[model samples]
Target: MPRSIWKGAISFGLVTIPVKLYSATEEKDIAFRQVHASDGGRIKYRRVCEIDGEEIPFPEIAKGYELADGRMVILEKEDFDNLPLATTKAVEVVQFVAEDEVDPTYFNKTYFMQADGPGTKPYVLLRDALVKTGQCALVKVALRSREALALVRPRDGLLVMHTMLWPDELRSGEFAAPPETVSVSDAEVTMAQSFIEALSGDFKPEEYTDAYREALEEVVQSKASGVAMPEQTEAPKEAEVVDLVAALRASVEAAKKRRAEGSAAATG
Candidate 1:
């Protein structure tokens, strides 16, 4: 089993259910290291004190917050440990609301919440209630010394917590919006609808693979073996759609053709 990163309690009304938090997702991207091209020496970093111009030890390093007037306020590890916040070691449920009420963009990281020894009963009760009601709990919790807003919901017999970005953290998209003067005809809208319908299907995440990562791995293998690298294909060029309706119609036809080919391959 994976080791739990955090131990906390879920404050469900007056009942406190002890729980352990585990990370739900991990990145599979290939890692690269910065090194001397000629000798393959690994790069390193050092911490130096600016005021005294001396190398600083890890224990002596402290976090500093810069002020608007250019003054730095140094804060020690002890300062964060003693903060007056109840959510520091607890999952305080604020309210339960319909799951659709929360936007997907607000979600950040995901973690699994497992009940501790005595709290298992209450955890099951809460999970069942959420599943039946189709609601998710809005909560406050602290992880890695930072407080966050999160949503807790039942998934595959486990309680999952998704940390959320604050409202102010989301920037306005007004600058990226198209001008109000731009408009589309009814026929163009219908064609776009057809394209969407042709391409729509149940989401199967496992069917997808990281093509770029696979290609990068092949390149690295070729270099290590002193073999010739695979020949590269020309990148696709974007079409300049002068007629929007014609482009939409073509897209719909292409989507339908692909779907038909996929179905035929599966049957054969």
Candidate 2:
């Protein structure tokens, strides 16, 4: 089992449900180490004090905040523990909102909340309530050294928490919007929507694979085994469409053809 990253209780009204938080997702990107290009000798680094010129160990390290006046303020673990925040040790429920009401752009990281000892019954109660009510709880909690706005919702019979961004953290997207001057004909809009319909299907996440990661893994394996690297395939080029309506019609036909091929392969 994966180790829990955080241990706290969900503050649901007057009830407390003790839970352990575990990261709900991971990246599969291949990792590489810094090395000498000539002979592949691994590169190493050391943390040394500027004044003493002595290498410092990890345990000896402490966070330092630099001031504009060229002064440093050192902080200890005890300092953070004494900070004024109720969320440091517990997840606090603030309010409930329809899940769709919260913009997905505010979401940051997700975690699975497993019930701790003696809290299983209450955890099940909260999870079931959320599932039945069709609403998610807006929450606040401190994790990874800071208090964060978060959401707790039930997913597949378990309580899931997602950290959210502050409202000010989001950038204005007005610049990306299409200008009012750029107008489209009704026919073009209909045909573009037709292309969308042709390509649409149930969103099966399992059907997609990261081809670039797979190719990168192959390259790494080849380098390790003294074999030739995998040959790269040329990307498909889009056909030039000078007319807007013709482009939309061609796209609809191409999308339909691809969908037909996919269906045939699935059935066969």
Candidate 3:
């Protein structure tokens, strides 16, 4: 079993349920190490103190807070352990709201919450209630020395927490909006709707693969085996739309043709 990263309690009104938090996702990206290209020797770095120009050991390292006037305050582990925030051992539920009300842009990481100690019954109660009402609990939690806004909801008989970004952390997009003069006609919109409808289907995440990562891996394997790299194909150029309605109509027809071919192949 995967080890839990955090141990805490969910404050359900006056009742408290002990829970363990585990990360719900894992990354599968290809990683590279820095090395001397000529000799294939691994590169190394040291944590050197700026003031003394001396290498510092891991045990001597402490968290530093730089003041506006350039003063540095070094804090130890005890300082963080004694922080005034209640989020240390508690996932404080502030309120419950409709899941759809939360914007997707604010979401960061997801973690699975499992019932611990004698909290299974209360955990199930909360999960079932959330599932029935289609709501999620807004909560505050602290993980890895930082407090965060989070949403707690039920998923497949389990409680999941999604960490959210603070409002100020989101960037304003006022500069990126299209100018007032840019507009689409009714006929173009209608054709675009038809095109979207033709291509609409249930999302199947398993159907997609990371083509770039796969190609990169093949390239690395070829170099390791002293074999020639695979020839690259030219990517299709994007069409510059002079007539929006014409482009939309062509897209709709192409989508329809693909759907018809797929259905025929399935039947055959």
Candidate 4:
């Protein structure tokens, strides 16, 4: 089992449920190390002081806040721990709202809450209640030296918390005005609706994959084994549509044909 990152309690009204927070997701991104192109040697960096031009050890490095006037304010670990922030390690549910009311844009990192011994009953109660009501609890939690707004919801018989981005952190998306001059005809809209209906199906996340990552993994394995890498063929580009209505009609027909072929292959 993976180790828990945080130990806290969920303050639900009069009850407090002790829980441990575990990261709900993990990144599978391919990472590369910096290396010299000619000799293939790993690159190394040293932290040097700007004023003294001397390499500084990790222990001697201190957090500094530089002022606009070229002055620096250094802070220690003790100073951070004594800061005037509510450092109480608890997830306080402030309000409950319909699950749809929470905009997905505000969501950041997600963590799974596991009941910490003695609090299992209360934790199950909250999870069941959320599942029945289909509501999410808006909460405040302190993690990583800062307080954050979070949403708690039930998922697979467990309470999951998603930290939210502050409203001010979200940028206004007013880059350009909507194209009012462009309009769609009823026939074009109907054909487009047909295309959508033909292509629509239940979303199964397992069916999709990162093809690029798989190809990169194959390349790495082949190179290690002294085998030739597989050749890749470029996909043919679609011809530009001169007529909007014609394109919509063609799309609907293509969707229907693909669906019919898929059904035939499945039955076969």
Candidate 5:
């Protein structure tokens, strides 16, 4: 099992479930390190003072908040510790709302809320309750040195906590003008519905593969073996101007063809 990033309790209406938070996702992208190109040496960065042009140690650094008139309010570690918000260690549930009411765009990172020792009963109860009622718990959690608003919801059979974006941070529809509705013929609407039906399939996430990762691995392997790298091919160019209605009709026909072929292959 992966190491737990945080150990905490989920609090709701006098009930607290001890849970270990584990990251739900992992980044597998190829990473490149900063290095000196000529000598192949690793590049290093230093914290230097803008005024004095001197390198400063980590211990000498203090947090600062910029003001309106180019002035800074420097703060020591003790200053933050004395703040009222810092004293709270518990994950406080503020409210429960319908899970569907929450917009997905507001969701940031996700963490698995695994039951800690003797927490299985309450954890399962909360999970079942959420599944049955279709409600999500809006909670406030202090993690990574900052207070975060989160949504605790059921995913599969486990509880997942997703950090929510602040209301002010979300863009409102008032920024853009509303779109005009266009009327479509019955024949076109029927064809579009048929296309959607043709394209429908089970959402098996495992079926998806990262072609870029595979290509990168192949390139790295070839270079490590001292083999000459193949020349990269340019992607085919698309038409600069496209007819929306024609494209939709063509896509529908393509989907229908794919579905027919799949059905035929299944029978054969």
Candidate 6:
């Protein structure tokens, strides 16, 4: 069983469902640490005051908000507690909207919501209802010392709470306008459509691999084994000017050849 990161409850109306939050994803990439080159000692950072040039302890650090230029209002723990909010240890569902209505770009991190105690029946019912309706529960949840908007939906047999980005945080109209109306040759259009049909296949996430990461790992392993490294060769540059139709034709042909070879290899 996965470890629960947070313990909370879902509150809708007067009913409260006790639940625990668990991480839905894991990082698998390699990580590095900063170290002194000469002594091989790890480097560390300290929070220090710029004016006094003195290290500030965690206890001395107080939350502050700048109201104007060079002016800040320091807030203590008690001051923050007085702020008006639901403050309930529950994820309060505000409304339910069609899942398609929510932009995918608004999604942030995700966490699994598991029932804490003997509330399995209600939890399962909620999950099933969400799946059947194809809707997501927009909720307000307070976690990690802040309030956040979360989308609750069913994934597998569990409820997943995905933190949503604020509307102001999302930029509008970043895409370019559609090209001006243009005429296309019937033969060109037919060939392009045929090429698309020939190259199309079911999307498979597992088929994608990070070649750069694999190469980096191989280099690291070789260095660790004291193997001699080969001299690197620079790849040739692509043409600055390209004929779109010609390029598309070449790509389609290459894809067809690759697929045929793969099929033949499997049969062999």
Query: Who wins the TM-score comparison?
Result: 3
lDDT tens string, model 2, 1-268? 9999999899999999999999999998888899999999999999999999999999999999999999999999999988898999899999999999999999999999999999999999999998889999999999988889999999988999999999999999999999999998998899889988888889989999999998888888898899997566999997777788899898899888888898899999
Could you estimate the TM-score for every candidate?
Answer: 0.94, 0.93, 0.95, 0.91, 0.80, 0.81
Task: Write model 3 residue lDDT over 1-268, tens digit each, in one string.
Answer: 9999999899999889999999999988899999999999999999999889999999999999999999999999999989998999999999999989999999999999999989999999999999998899999999998999999999888999999999999999999999999988889889989988999999989979998889889989999999998677999999898998888888888899999999899899
Q: Whose TM-score is higher: candidate 1's or candidate 4's? A: 1
Tell me the lDDT of candidate 1.
Answer: 0.93
Give each model's clash number.
Answer: 0, 0, 0, 0, 0, 0
Kindly report which residue stretches of model 2 are placed more than 4 angstroms away from their true locations once superposed. 230-233
lDDT of 6 by residue, 178-241 (tens): 6568666776687688688887889988989888778788888888999977878999997754
- Give candidate 3's error at residue 81 in angstroms: 1.2
| TM-score of model 3 (CA atoms) | 0.95
Off by over 4 Å in 1: 68-71
Off by over 4 Å in 6: 36-41, 76-83, 173-196, 231-236, 264-268
Could you tell me which residue pairs clash in candidate 2?
A: none
lDDT of each: 0.93, 0.93, 0.94, 0.89, 0.85, 0.83
What candidate 4 gets wrong by more than 4 Å, as runs, is: none
Model 2 collision count: 0
- 170-262: candidate 5 lDDT, tens digit per residue: 887775765568566776677677778778989978968999999999999998999978888999997653555566678888988887897
RMSD of 5: 3.4
